[model samples]
Target: MKIVKVFLVLSVLLSITGCSPLVNNNPTKVETSSNGSYKALLFVNGMELQSVGHTANESELVVGEFIGAVNEKVDIEIRPSDELTSNYLEEGTEIYSVEGNTKIVLAKKENGDYEVFE
Candidate 1:
């Protein structure tokens, strides 16, 4: 009887603990513009993630490491690409500029929503 009760309690505890978010060791992927003149750089937990740009119907840049826990923050910086000297006005290129840089900070909430801060 005592062993049965202990087993039930342990099962409940395991289920509760499993409700938390899981950590991802891999980096996040982001879509970019095919003809855009900017690239986005991402930092998570103070580490620069490995990212690459690929060309499909459009261009995409995979950036950032996934946030491992709630309240963890990710920072992104958009800069002008060296391939293009001048900033191009496009859908994804709006974030890039030569006069000033664009940066955003995002924090993961318990509800799985990301709070964005400039």
Candidate 2:
């Protein structure tokens, strides 16, 4: 009947509108360190990760591993190579090493951005 056709058309239109992807208007801000000479170590779920070193100009560490979920937290420590080795004190966990640089700490924000520290 005519009523059935009208209901069906409305349902289809509603479904199509509801299927649109979400848009985030307020984007998250990225944090960067001021020190030009610093080193960072990235850790995910307490496991050290091998990542490309981020310079003072770069705000975020470039990670090769795939982060499965959004807003996943990562811990970063900026310290001397010797101190890190001494503190961690674990074999085969030393992923990257930098010499003659100050250490800094970084944490992942809830919005999936790195919060840089001095």
Top lDDT prediction, candidate number: 2
All candidates' TM-scores?
0.26, 0.23
Each candidate: what lDDT? 0.34, 0.36
Off by over 4 Å in 1: 22-40, 43-97, 100-118
For model 2, the superposed segments whose C-alpha errors exceed 4 Å read 23-118
* Cα misplacement distance, residue 72 of candidate 2 (Å): 23
Q: What tens digits encode model 2's per-residue C-alpha lDDT throughout 1-118?
A: 9999999999998998788654322222112357643233343343433333433237444423322222222222332222223121132332222223224333334444443333
Cα displacement (angstroms), candidate 2, residue 66, comes to 37
Candidate 2 least-lDDT 10 residues: 80-89
Q: Go through the candidates in order and give the clash count of each.
A: 0, 3
